[model samples]
Target: MGNTESVVVQKRLTRFRPEERPVIEGVFDRLQGGAGGPSGAPGKTPAGKTLTLEMLQSSMGSLAPDSMVRRIYQCMCRIDPGMAAPAASGKTSTPTASGVGREQLVIFLADTMRGTAEERAPLVLAMSQHGAGAAAVVTCEQVAEFLQDLISAVVQILVHRGRLQAWKPEKMGDGSLGVKLLAEQMCSELKPSDQGACDVSCLEDWIFRVSQVSLYLEMLVAEGLNVSLSSRLAPTLLPPCRETPWKELRCLLDLPVLMFLAPQLPDSYNAPWRLVFSTQLHGESFTRVVTGLTNCGPTLLLIKDTKGHVFGGFASHAWEVKPQFQGDSRCFLFTVFPRLRVYTATGYNQHFMYLNHSQQTMPNGLGMGGQHGYFGLWLDSEFGRGHSRARPKCTTYGSPQLSGEEDFTLDSMEVWAVGKPPEPEEGEEGQGKRSVLHMDPEVQAIMEMTGKTLHSQGFREPEEDQE
Candidate 1:
């Protein structure tokens, strides 16, 4: 920034009173629900003059130049919550419901003003360059719109260097989608979020929304759950629905990455990441609710055992109950509450973890092991819970495995799907490749007794590649 501009920014920064300074680590700490603080008090930082540039950088978890800018942006939002374009003069619409209080500001910081320094610099510059006398009401959207126009050249750099190409299904061959994105379109595909129940009236409200989303993602990573967020790291897409289960466990929604799915979805397709999906539904009613769940895509399945312990799997594909096997490698079992432990696909011991119907015969149910089966976990067609037993196959996950020999019955089943399910246009690529092909266990047993190979209709082994 020029000398005049720097002086202007400093003056604006000092506008807020010392009493308003945060006592703790800014808004992020508060969102953590006081996870770490003196006396476990809510994260309200003390009002102080220490929010200088150096202090801001030190507070940043990421040291990138852009990350530093983001830190400054956070400080500005907190210290100058009043800085903004004014609410409209006409109809007094209610503020966005979710954005009504503190949480709204957090989301604005995390989403709208996020990305690299180049992405957020214009907003900072706009605020700094504005003459103090004018003090125009600067909405976050207005700043964003201004940046798009002024930085068209920067965006053009991407156009000259990159071009769109059709995506094919495969395991991420090391993040080689062969392209670099323009700044403007980086998060372009995520659906334009519903402005909650109402529209944001002023600037500070936008900042809070950004702040909230940023804190949530950072917390997710700090807790050690895997999430793909960086532009360079993380595959564009995991193996398709057939080859693998989950699309990709991305922490933040990125348009370039999401558009790689087969059926191209809308720019406003992002929603699942904004909220917590902890609702419970029953097995009997599950099928009915499954389609609607496509909006909140893949989900977590929790089964409460008769012993009062809860265990379940992550359904990599959307919940669709057909008379056959669906889903892929992304599906894995997990346990929440009494300590979190996730058991991923061993690839080797996959015979039992897959979903199937006709092959089992008798009662159409999930397949555990072939012919010599081990009913490690089972949920009946009824809405009630099923059974879980200890299993040798799940040993790699440590401790006593899920299923037991005594046929432990479960008490309840709860499911949670995140985001909207991939659209039919977005393409499920490898899912839904099989259907009811298993005969009754009795008839199959008799056929096996008479020396018959149990092959589901249309089941064919692929030919080996010729050298």
Candidate 2:
């Protein structure tokens, strides 16, 4: 009997450490008959089972609701000494209805945002149950703005670190480098006049100038021209003949060419650059005059009608020629537009310019004296809207609610660049590609479970977590 008693004492000692004694004693004090006589003292209990009663009370309080409920059966073994079966295998009763305040909702949302995916799920679920779910409150516009700010911050960080690619002198030439550097510096120095919304209009102009400079540099690089010398000699290349009729006409037709060649023209009329002209007599005895010159190579002149019908040929030799045409006497205009395709090897850009005598009275008309004539020379890629897609809309919330309505809630917003899709397999069969839109299955499951638990706790979804 002594040996058996010793074993029992050892087991009881192993069940709880000395530090846990106060907690056990506290639970017993709360459960026993309030501080009064026989009913309160442990020693006066019937069958001398006060120790067992105290253990049971402590055990129930210690069992975490998050853990599997079945474990409570094992805990009861030490608490209820004479019990043959375990307590009910289920969750505790839900909390009573008590409305959470707005400040409390916000705090809850902040906490949820900091929590793990598992911890957050229940909070989201509770919010949904309370009708103050994410969908009912948060707005898509707010989400978009948040995303934009996030992206801008990330881009700024990357640019500061110098991880982004810069213009390569060897590949883009000295002229290109100078232009790009100037643009970058200008952008860095310019401060927005207003702190309203993000305005990218100023950046558009900078982009156009950069494109022009880059194209010019690329052309020189293709011809193996030394940019340093070319830049120095730019002003001296053009002659005083800039006032000449033909020169003016060419400038009107191609504005970009004029801007690009302006710095390279010579002060005097050395006429180092060749000039050529050709006129063809058509079937109606009308003269189709073509006048242009190029320092690079042979220029291909193509004249097309309103119906996209071509009628011109390449001028290999400078000689007067005649052509035949069956069309009526229609006003034919010479115009140019940038080629849709890019030629990196030749550094030849497809640019367009147009002249329409018929639309002389239109709001945007063409003339020799007006600014419209130099269209091609001033044509820039940056002046218009850049490439971008429309973003989807989202909802917003001003406060948290307790009505069952939405699927989820968000506390903080994050934006990420779209990455390249994975390459397709060469030989795999019956395999499907993954989509960027959907969340992972494991994440969904965890969120679902979290929501259920939070709902049971009678907590409404937090407000700050709404998108």
Best by lDDT: 1
Error of 2 at 303 (Å): 3.6
Candidate 1 segments exceeding 4 Å error: 1-297, 319-324, 352-362, 366-376, 383-385, 395-400, 403-406, 425-467
TM match of model 1 to true structure: 0.31
Model 2's TM-score against the true structure: 0.17
Model 2 Cα shift for residue 232 (angstroms): 4.5
27 in model 1: Cα distance from truth in Å?
A: 16
What is every candidate's alpha-carbon RMSD to the true fold?
Answer: 20.9, 34.1
lDDT of 1 by residue, 297-366 (tens): 5655555566655556655555444544445655566543233345555555443333333334545444
Off by over 4 Å in 2: 1-243, 246-252, 258-304, 307-314, 320-335, 338-467
| Shift of residue 299 alpha carbon in model 1, Å | 2.4
lDDT (tens digit, per residue) of candidate 2 on 106-206:
22222222223332222222221212111212222322222222222222222333433221112211332222333333233323335422122332233
